[model samples]
Target chain A: MREIAAVFLSTVRMNFRDRRSLIFMILFPIVLTLILGTALSSVSGSSDTAEKLDSRAALINQDHGAMAGRMEKFFRSPEIRKIVHTKTYRSLSTAKADLKKQKLDAIIVINKGFTQAVENGSSKKLDFITSGDMESSLIKNITQSYLQRINAYRAAAAFAPQPAAPLLADHALSINGKIPRSSDYYAVTMLIMIILYASAYGLNVVREMNLSPIGYRIRSLPVRQINYLIGKTLGQLATVFLQIIVLVTFFKFIYHANFGSNLPFIFLVCFLLGFIIILLSIALALLFSYKMADTILDLAIPVATFLAGGYVKLSILDTNPIAVALNSWLPNAVAQNLVFQNIYGGTGQTAAGGVLKLTLIALAILLLTIAALRRNNHADLSK
Target chain B: MIIEVNDLIKRYKDFLAIDHLNLTIGDGELFGLLGPNGAGKTTLVNAILGLTAVDHGTINVFGEALSTSERAIKKQIGLVPQDIAVYPELTAQENVTLFGKLFGLRGEALRKGVADALEFTGLTDIRNKKPSQFSGGMKRRLNIACAIVHKPRLIIMDEPTVGIDPQSRNYILESVKKLNDMHCTVIYISHYMEEVASICTRIAIVDKGRIIAKGTQEELGRLIEDDQVVSVGVTAPDYSIIEKLKRLPAVKDATVDGHTIRIVLSERKLNAVLDTFLEEDLTITKIETNTPTLEDVFLTLTGRALREGAQ
Candidate 1:
């Protein structure tokens, strides 16, 4: 035990003495968090401008009758007014140019004899034009719904229309419900990214195992292999814990990050998350050769973070079999959803279940890391 | 006995690093394992220290097997490696004290041990300085101090004088002598024949992973019968002089190169040859005689210099 403690102290001293590692481990994360947080905060305040939908369209009305007037009235409906800000263009060429320049999302053309054909019980063809690869899917869906409502109104007129005014009023006003802000989504993403970076710092402990002169000295001592490894692990855990405290405090007080009602619970969750990352880092240091550790971490961290839903919504995977399977098993994804749900006032067994599952996964990873270290110890002895 | 090795074999893949080697060192004996580089000296020392595993034999230290009972054996052994092993950040005293604590020494005892080791290695004035601030010699001294702070029963030094100034080398050599005098069993490994000759009571010459020769200085020196090496400056001696000296009953071999005549002769016949040279009226500008040193014996047996890698 004393030997282990000595080794631990020696490792700490060496790490503290190395100026570059000191700055990288202790100061770099805080700087990154502050920069990203401030940028995200500014973005959150600009949510209003981002929520306005563009609706500039070209109208070629060939149906010169009541139906054409009614269609124009439908476009000017109060419901559509809340959802889209529309502009009219006369020609397809001008409209194409505008759509190409991103001034319009699409163009709508009413074909010739459209109202005459509809009155004679014949189907009328309406043409819609859009620039290549524009975000026309949403416009397509809304247009289809509008045409369906018009068809229903026509059917009611034919059946025995009794006061279709209320139906028209309902169709005139667009549903103006607010979608979630992009900044909120980005903040969640940035938080997940910073946490992963913090976790990568734990890899520094593994790096110390190979680079530290103190580690070399310990290897030459009479100390048991297991004791020396335990000392290193404990020392690294302490470092990660300190880092977590600093990051948590900065996010809480400085950036006013809303982590939600269970502050203590959140802290516990983050601590366990950090602990598992540190253990994995140590295992990486032991399993891979030193020269390859950096490369491996570079490739692994980003992929793991992305798969854990750094940018995309986890619900996008409701129909994706692979994503669903991984979402249930991957700790980072689960922790991300749990923390976000907690902040958004989601309280239920499902949220708690996700947290529990993530905790269990972290525990399993830690156990695997310990087992790898033991195997490495035996190999060292034989060597 | 402080260390005993019996048929120790260490193989690295297909090549044998230490081959069926047997050795023993009594308590307080400053035994020297003298050999050229790659002669398995370091390998044998590492095996005894349990730093490397043995393939087919046993190593006993203080009457206990070192391979299986490493912790017990290592607690009583000190090693000053050829490389610098001290912490670059810590002062010499701190490094010494840290190592002492590992051996279960602390408080006043630890302080005294550090001070004594520094004093013994002649670094008392620089104890508070970090190893990075010291010269190569001072660092080497600190390496030794750290190893010996716990005062282990046996101390193993592997080429400790390598790549240092002569002053530091002499200091380290003197310190080793002092340690041996203080009743510590020392295992000195080096390729320098003179170092082995100066202080070793028993020297073993290892070559190609095996002990080619072993004995006291005189006993090994007697391996070659031609004990007298004579170099004479003859003021441009004629080629006939080499032929004439070769015919003489006392001369084993004689060669004439330019103005000098060099000869090896049996010790008993050295005087007779000198008398014959004088009688022949040769203009001998210089004459020097030397008994066969370890170098001569090394050359005689291996047909190569003992300091194979010396610069």
Candidate 2:
């Protein structure tokens, strides 16, 4: 136990001493919280009193094909205009400038060969540009849903001369009743994103215990492999714990973000996310080289955040069961949704279930990490 | 013997790293292992530390079979890796204490062990300073300090003085000698021929995954020759004296190069050779003999300079 404590303390001290990376992790999120909290304040409000803000979007139609004409008609159509106010632009650059300047929330561009590509079915990419995610998410979703319907209707029109106009799908992706005060909402979300970045923590700490030159020195000592693992994992957890506390305190007091009364539960959820990140890092470290593992997690974190609706209101195919399950089950999304649900007026059933799911996921990652370590025990980790 | 390896064979795919290698190291012997790059030195070290699994052989450290329960076996072993693996974030004392605790030194024992290590490495005064503030040689001393805090029976030093100043290099070499004097077996690996030649009691030259030569410095020097030449420089090279020296028993040949008379003998008979020159009433201004050094032995056996590995 003493040996384990020594290992654990060294890891924690090493991490704390790395002032550069730690300061970045703690301060970057606080900065983002200030910017995002103020920008999305009205749109992301308390679940009950949170009212949707008016959304604005621009459409640029450069295609001379028949399908391009229908796409322009869909944007100008009265149904999409009810939820999202749409403007028509003759030039793509003008629409892009308007979006970048914040005059528009989003801009959807349809390239020149829209009808020809739709007919031949080679490749079609709808470019969605947004200044900020909160208001733009609504416009992006509507445009995408319209595109999905266009493809279905275009095929149907080929088989049987269909109606004269395209129609909006019967279903719409809604944000549901989970919008909390934007400052508090971003405070929680931005914190979760930074904690998920803990995925690299294990790579840094584990490298010292092995893989680095230090590993050869330490591994030759009297300590057992298991002691090194326990000490390192605990130390990483302790370091991450310190980082989350500082950020959470800053969000709650300095930034005036909301945590409701469930600060303990909020911390619990964030802790699980941090644990999973460390475990995932260890798993990757055991399986791959340090550079490879670091890169994989570096690329993976943002993608996970995007899918979790962290950057914007994720309303893509939300009506479908698969989409709903995937969005609600992502580690970041689940943690974020639970905090919002707890702060707003919601039963404990959803939060309870989400906690269970996250706990299971963390456990699974822990098991996997141990397995990888054990499998690679006989192999040399030195350079 | 404190350590034994019999016919150890380790292969990575088609590359045989340790090819049926056999070796034994006795207690209190300061063993020097010399090898070129990719000569299986690391593999052998890893095998002894129980870090690698051998294909067909056995390694017994402290008279016990090497196995995964190496916790006990590993406790008696210390390693000073080639690189300065000390944690730069830690103070000199903390680095020593942490490693001591890891090696199972308790409160007071741990404290004393740390103090001893720091003092021995001359780091007592700057024990509070972090390694980041240290010079290259200071860092190298701290590296040894970390390894010795636990006082293991067997310590393996792999190029511990590779890039340090002369003072630190001498200090490190001194520490190795002290460790051996205390009856601790040391396996010293270095590319520096002079360093190995000056310290190691018994040296082994490994090449291509096998021990090509192993013995005292003199024994290895003798490996390439059965006889030695004696070169005597005199003011005058008279034919009578040269002819008389060549006729002496056990003298293979006596030849003249400028003012030097070169004599070949099947064995060392320095007195007889000198007596012949002294009896001739000749003024011997200079006398010279060629003795093989560790560098020559390594170059002769491996056909490559040992420092080639360092480059």
iRMSD (Å) of candidate 2?
Answer: 1.8
Task: Give a tens-digit lDDT track for model 1, residues A182-280.
Answer: 344444455555555554555655554446544444555677767767776666565555655665666667656555557666656666666666676
State model 2's lDDT: 0.77
Off by over 4 Å in 2: A38-179, A317-323, A347-349, A380-383, B225-289
Q: Which ten residues in a row have the lowest lDDT in candidate 1 chain A?
A: A166-175
Most DockQ-accurate candidate: 2
DockQ of each: 0.23, 0.42
lDDT of residue A326 for candidate 1 = 66
Query: lDDT by residue for model 1 over B68-186, one digit each (tens)?
Result: 67787777888887778887867888788888877667679888988888888888898888998999888889989988998888998888888899999999999999999899989
Please state the CAPRI-style docking class of candidate 1: incorrect
> For residue B178, what is the lDDT in candidate 1?
91
10 residues in a row with least lDDT, candidate 2 chain B: B302-311
lDDT by residue (tens digit), candidate 2, B1-311: 88999999988778788888989999999999988767888889988987776788999998998684588888888888888888888899999998898888987999999999999999999999999999899998999899889888999998899878998889889989999999999999876778988999999898788998999999998885655667788888776887887677866666676898876665677777788778988899887776756766776566566667733
Q: RMSDs, each prediction?
A: 10.8, 10.9
